[model samples]
Target: MAEARRPRAIDLYSGIGGWSLGLRLAGIEVVASYERWGPANETNFKNNHHQAQTVDIRRLSFADLPDGIDIVVGSPPCTQFSFSNRGGNGDLEDGLEDIVTFLGIVDHLKPKVWAMENVPRVAPIITKELESGGRLHAFSHLDVQTHILNLEEFGLPQRRRRCVAGNFDMERLRAYASRLERLTLGDVVVALGQDPVCDPLYGLRIPKAQLVDHDPEPALNPEELRINRANKTAHTVYNAMPFPDRMERAVRTITATCTRVSRESIVIAPPETPDCVRRLTIRERASLQGFPITFQFYGATYAQKLRMVGNAVPPAFTYLMGHVFQGTDAEALPPLASHAEHLTAPAPPAVLTPPDRPGSVFPPTRSFRFAIQSLQLKSGVRFELRNRFADGQTEWSVDFYFGTSKNIIALQMDHALRTRLVMAIPARLRREVETALAGVSTYVEAADIENMQRVWTHKGVGGTRPFMLLDELDQAGKGLVEVLQSEPEVSRAVVDAAITARFGDDRPAVGLAKLGRNAPVIAAGLLIGSAANGALRTHHLRTTGRSPKTKSH
Candidate 1:
């Protein structure tokens, strides 16, 4: 019998070798890697024992890559095409150029199998190009076998979702899918042990805060201080909370932002504890991102390490994909039962106590919709109710809290709606409001009391004027509301149009103006557009500048 051939592969934009590691694990030999980042290249070299050429993909030629490569797998830099980049902004053009160049290489080399991984939004764009070029047939060796696989379905810990497109066989991918495995945050955390935590301030080794002599009541005055106190209380339960059931199926996408910095958008782990404010440490983050414990990143700063982890493909996810591409059945292989069993056992509980009193006034809930609308006429602070009733009817209300006083400045609403309000006031007036509300239950309506007081004093006041000072609140609230209300397809269209307007148009000034006024809108449009048919079409129009109505000769 003839010996089986070891598949040869090349990785482009191979940051820290996430895809490469996965391919390597599945018995694919990564002959060469191309990457631009120095730190990532250094780490990839150290861990993979493979020398990576530091070169920008745009400037490099197909001749520069290793010849006779059986497979080519990569994830191009997504920032230009990502939702975060001002709706693809100027980067959309650049992203397209890069994609074309990349596809050009693919067409020239005509590898037996090629896989490209990127954010889900990139799929439509790639699919359009593949179909137009007639490369899809050549790549897949068939017309109908286009594959797009999600990382979540394969069972990695983090909720990092990506789209995979390739010329790989469908039967192979199906076989790989049948043997998919899921992992949770706990599975990864416990397997790695407690010593090197993701957040240095709070991980496994650092003991949870002791409850002895701890005051649970929120502080009076200094609104920022109050918020900080509330956050601390929320953290108590978040840190000790076990991984939810859904988490086992997929992990949340680890973001670049610090977990401790923002109250409005932190991932809550349940079973609260005081130590929750700390961000995930480098090690824990790496684990969550599916990097092996043995894969070490050598970086001078924490930020550098974070970038490395964030950029890399989840190795386990990649491994499964690799097996699929190679036409192998992972399930037919003997089960690694002992390895699987080691991941499920629970660790001893950390010593931490929950706060007795209301540690902070604000409760973290997903149902809140906040907006700061500087309307033409009325613009105070507006919040939309997101809470749902059993009958599906929603309630709406609005309240204004005077800074530091804890008293309702005013309340206005037509009916019960879903929204809550928290006010931040200057520290000086806290005592007065505390004194006034001394005997009142925390639940009493401050707005009602204020209205009664106004009527009793016979002071006829017109509707309250909008508070100009709440500009930031209005902006943040409106942004949130807009995001919540937007349909995925519509949002994508707007983002795509914005990006096209900015980069594709000959009138550079107009694009620049749109970017200057509201970058987020453009970003949303691009993200949405990228996910739908419009983004690619817009790109085509921008590149070719053709009107559909104009007839060809």
Candidate 2:
């Protein structure tokens, strides 16, 4: 009797072989994988021994794949649709291009089944009818089902919520789900004082050197400390994370980008030095995502390796999917039970628990409420942001009030974005603003003037309280130097002085007379009237020999 040939499959966008390894474990042969990033493809090949092709998926057609690919699985990049990106406000047209390509191949190949996964936000976009065949909208004709699954339920040790759409049998997979028990952070990743029940293989993969604690985060950087603290609130005071992580339930989502600055990176206080906090090592992060110890990731930099690990589908969960696709029974493996040492360990110091959250989201001593309620530019454009600021720092829709339009939002912008917007202004004007800024000790931005008509959105970082952008739903002249509530440091005089110098006394100057203490130290914009705007444009056209772009205003 001859050995039975295993059903062949292909993994697209296979990052570190999460899908490939899982499917293979389910008795399917992952014959080939297609990825565009060299590091990821190289890692896939090294680990899984598949023919990893660094080909652009857009150019792939029927001829490129093997004749009989029983399964086609891929995760199109989720940057555009993810809520973490621009608060779910990314350009849909640009984001859907890759998805269109992925679906096109599935349509072309007409495989027995296919699967695609992405952040939960992508669920509505893919399922609802979109455009015609040239694009991927309205693919209900393909007959695939979409399931929004939480990895915690399937026994993974992190809170990973994903929308998986596939033709694989749900009933078979559902059966596998029933037999599995939920696992928590303590079961996998190492934490302070934990006697972990993590797989022994994980111990083998982590070097003894890697087990050493990271140096403590600087204690005095108040702003970084504030951000980390706010993230426990998760953009709201309503839902909070255990400060130094309780290790009781699954930890928060493990993002592709991990930093100590945001709560997404698991923070722990070493038992030996309880006050000092450090992030989980790379090996721990890998373990959190359900990658076994022996799995190797090849990359030039630590960042690249982390990206591969973070972006992967949890192989533990996928193994079940492989069984569903292969029409086979999954061996019932009981979830790891909690170890007594892990359950009884002492808590990390300082951050994890407080009946009430620490510090203030908005300055309690804000001067704006007592000062002026609103500020009007000399040109009659009225601006107001105090009410928003008074609402809370915990809730920032408009950190900088530009005007009254939805496109022009009022939100607290991080330093990087603030710098980028500042850099867009012409040098001469920039210099002028900077010179005046010395008096107010604030910033001058083209966002209120040049970017007035430009649509702006904020991306929410996972595990952090977002300075979520608030839509300015006022009249047409959206965004004004409204009496926006500001940091305690920004005084009424500061706003008045900036407005005075930025627009000069005679130009469309912002009048801060209405604001006092609470007035938002808005990085006030130059309120260039139509005539002045035209003059600046004309000057630029003559100076540079370029046709003027009519301002969208």
Candidate 3:
């Protein structure tokens, strides 16, 4: 008997042909793609070398497709089922209606295999539909298998967990599943060009750095100038903020709002070039979403690229699935030796530190309360700080876990106001928190000692806390007076004054700040400050020259 040829696939609801791309990579022939969106259809046509029909999936009949489609795959519009949708109501019934109509076509065509991908929340509904339609039993006729998979397992950098149900033989899929490689953000970013730093593999483009209003300039106010001078050298310090463990095998799901401001936040780090934005480009977004670099989109705007990336299935994941359906052992397939050259060092081990001492973690019980209440009110960390009284003494401590490692700051307080730190970390995240703290320096600043002591003295509060006070540490011990002088805000006199105040004549700050003049310190300071404060309300650190009667400093 002769060996069987690879199966043919038809992609329905194909937006820019992600499913088709994966199928093609796996050696499956994509005969046609059906899409409702015009731009997506055009882009699909451009990339696949086949014209995609701009027809609605609901109106699509089996007759519209060519014969001999061994497999059918699609990811229907999930807006109606998404929790983000206004309470997930309105047109939901219609969405289900569309799904049924789609399934009806699948049934009519009788493709040997069919797969549908969607948010995991839709699993119950899909399962119910399959049972009702006897599709589960139908799989036996074609030796079909189905599963809901997490894309992270297939080496995507983002944490996209989706449900994938298909009719394929289980034995066939297991063969390839074992050999699947794990993908990381670093793996994809490294493949980009050396100068522009755009990932060629995924067609991600880095936009030229525009001089936005937020760029380094003169401080808006005198106080800002002072702070900008003080922290001028802080701007070029990459990875100064703490990050989660870099070598962990698992990748956190990348959300629509994902950015790399804090250690907990995952960001795509382009080259240390000047003409790059901090966020991931459209092509990088697609790569992270699992689309290959060769995939070209025709949309004019970056938003279109984002839509195509967000809407499409990761090609790597789909290719793995396709291989499984074909009874091929993809994992056993020889690894691409070329890809091995890109692999970097594994992530380092995480460091664990103790929490603050009672009352010493906060300046005072009242200050601890204010800080906790402020964080809670800010809607960022949502941690609760509480003061507990035991044996006529007050105990103050923090009671929540922050999601990002970079956001962790050393707290100081008076010793008498010592209270225990209570962290309400969920069981699932305990290990991740532990891993992130490993190898990271957690020190308490002299300014924050009083506040930290107050929170650590009390009982019924204990959690993993990094002891490093990052801000107080002297990193690359160079001053910023020279850097301040170039700042748009600081006058030459102001820079000279700052330098004299710090070091009589050496002007360490000025000298160091001058190292990267094009990348001004003041601008970096403003960005860091605004990001930390969650807004740009404060920029300058001005003060009146005359001393007030009540002033102690």
Candidate 4:
């Protein structure tokens, strides 16, 4: 009798082969994979002998794949569907493009069965009626069943809930879910701590259980640390924090941005020293995602490693589904008792919502409150940040306020973002700002503006936050002085003198006075208007090349 061949399958968007690893372990041969990211594709090649194609799915053609593949499995990018996105809804265009391409691949292959996985919110989008024949014919009628499976139910540690769509039998998969034992983050931590055995076949560097993906975060003061310990929760920073994951249970979904320290990043303190909390290592994160101990991730930096791990589907969960898909018998396996019940739960409302500390330039009054509360100011606006000397090595950092409609906002500026904001200004203004900033020795990184924007939404408000540009000469820095000198009758000294004398004061005045010209009374009427009722009311405007408009009385 001739030996039977293993069933063939193709994996798309195969980040680190998480989905394919499971199927391969379940007796399926994943011959090829389609991945656009270079580091992730390298990981796939290392784990499985997948001839991964480094082509964008949108541009991939049917001729690019192998013949007679039985199944097509992929988990398209789900960032756009994630809840972490600001305002809870991400841009649909990016997610839709990947989803369409994945479907197109399936349509091109016309595999016996195809499975697509994404965030639960994406279920409707995937199940919506999509035309076939041109790209993916399997989605022509959109008859595929959508299964909302929590990875925890399949015995993988994570509590991630993903929407899986496929033509395969769901009951068969559900039957096998009970056959696996419950896993947790503790198990993953323990497994990763074990020393790697030397493999004679492939001599890869066996990294120890040391911490990775750690960034240089500002250390908390002793008092702050004490407070955090007493509270036993993630500390608040920059008004936003990530929801910390409980170690006893499966972690929340790992995100690609976890490489950078965030409030939501999982923090663990060793049993001996519970005071020191640190982000999880890349290897540990991979283990939490159910990659085997022997599995190795190759990347030049922690960022690449984190991105691969965060985006990968847990292999253990995938393996169970793959086993069921391959018609494996659901023989009852011994159930392991879960120990998570004994672990004490953390305090509710994960983010610590403490009131913002008082700002130097702006007070904590209702007027200032409305400034920060308004959602109208878009991200990436530049503000002139000033650090004025206070007491003994302490300086008060203040954001320059800009008026918008009825609200006022102080622009936040970080070193890296400030450089980009200055550079991005109009060519003539940029030259003047740069000339005035010549003596300042801070580093300039025009390229890092986007990265800074990802973390902190506000910074140097160049033209973006233009509430009182050139209004008061004292408020204008040397850079602003140079830029404003272009206006008629405006000079550096003239601006200084006007600011000093407080002439043409726009703010509300407390008292009124009468004045005459040439020592002769031109008009006997007293100046009745207060500064609040001055004609020069603050004007608020966006940088969309439109004139500023003052609110009506």
How many residue pairs clash in each candidate at the backbone level? 40, 32, 87, 12
Better of 1 and 3 by TM-score: 1
Quote each prediction's TM-score.
0.53, 0.58, 0.51, 0.55
Tens digits of per-residue lDDT for model 3, 407-526: 432222211111110022234433432232221112221123323333343322433211222221112011221333344333232223323443467543223343233222322222
Candidate closest to the true structure, highest lDDT: 2
Given candidate 1, what's the lDDT at residue 367? 30
Which parts of model 3 have CA positions greater than 4 angstroms off?
1-6, 87-91, 130-146, 193-251, 254-277, 331-553
For 409-442, candidate 4 gives per-residue lDDT tens digits of: 3323223334433433456554654543432221
Give the better candidate number (3 or 4) by TM-score. 4
**Residue 67 in candidate 3 has what lDDT?**
84
Alpha-carbon local distance difference test for all models = 0.47, 0.54, 0.46, 0.50
What order do you get sorting by TM-score, best first?
2, 4, 1, 3
Error of 4 at 218 (Å): 11
Per-residue C-alpha lDDT of model 1 across residues 140-160, encoded as one tens digit per residue: 332323345555565566666
Better of 1 and 2 by lDDT: 2
Worst 10 residues of 4 by lDDT: 519-528
Q: What ranges in model 2 sit over 4 Å off? A: 130-134, 137-139, 191-223, 234-239, 270-272, 330-553
